[model samples]
Target: MEHVAKTRDRITLTGVRVRAHHGVFDFEREAGQEFVIDVSVAVDLAAAASGDDLARTVHYGELAEAISAAVERDPVDLIETVAERVASVALAFPAVEEVEVTVHKPQAPITVPFTDVAVTIVRGRA
Candidate 1:
């Protein structure tokens, strides 16, 4: 949930690659696959920018690690659930007001040829 005030400034992390086991099939869970992720978080950056303080703004490096850990920690059947988990992690940061998460499965077990399969979600304080 979004716990922060409305802000135009945002931090974005794109194309994070991770190996994870997330699928409906047992084979998929056993084999695992490479997942590409994208995350955008909205936050107020004026204080941090003006004061040159890291504490007042979202730390993207930590955010990336957190999202990666979130994806790696659990096994789920749907990317939607993965997106929610990432959103929760981003919003847990004090400066984050909103978050958008996209989970990409490049090697999904689809019968037909496809470039990628992904789920995107946006969350804010309730």
Candidate 2:
């Protein structure tokens, strides 16, 4: 008798941060600052594991590119919006069942220097 290992059914990514400019302040939008983003997606990887098909798995490269594009394409007033957009993009993949996005602004022009400022959002397919 032969035993076969069951393939994992979920996919997760973490610490996917990028630098960009996103803020409501005029200086932030004009001067261009650095913003970091972390994202994770719950996806079904069984198909890809069984069939060895790239299409069956969510491509991290593409996901990263999409996030980068979104961050660079426009300037928003809030990190909440950035988180929402990143989560939305992650959910666009058919294999992704749910997504979590966190946007960090480390260099926010606050009155005092802080460790970091960030926003996290989660979204799922209905």
Candidate 3:
């Protein structure tokens, strides 16, 4: 058999806010904070576009809910872990060929002033 590279269309969900306790510090875990999540999935959309069926495409509403659950339900020390978990969930979808996840911690316990702290990860099947 021969192999062919496939090009995928992207579906993105940005700025998904959730309240969660995820941190190494005790104070952080005690006082939960709002987390921002962003997710992007790559998939073939031709079938969905032509068929105009919900089953043919990955549902953004469902995907967003799943991602929010991952962030809120589980507490981890690093945002990297959160990003990885989110990517795994996205990749599990049949329509998703690849996924990229970003977990943002805006209210971090930092002594200096900063905009945000985040971790981004990309995962896919070859």
Identify the leading candidate in terms of lDDT: 1
Report clash pairs, candidate 3. none
**Every model's TM-score:** 0.94, 0.84, 0.94
Clashes of each: 3, 1, 0
For model 2, state the Cα shift of residue 26 in Å. Answer: 0.9
Candidate order (TM-score): 3, 1, 2
TM-score of predicted structure 3: 0.94
lDDT of 1 by residue, 79-105 (tens): 899999999999999889889999999
Q: Rate the local accuracy (lDDT) of all candidates.
A: 0.92, 0.78, 0.90
Residues 1-126, candidate 2, lDDT per residue (tens digit)? 899553335555555666666788888878877778788787667678799999989888898888888877677888898888888888888888878788888888889869998888878787
Error of 3 at 25 (Å): 0.3
> Whole-model lDDT, candidate 3?
0.90
- The window of 10 residues in a row where model 2 has the poorest summed lDDT is 4-13
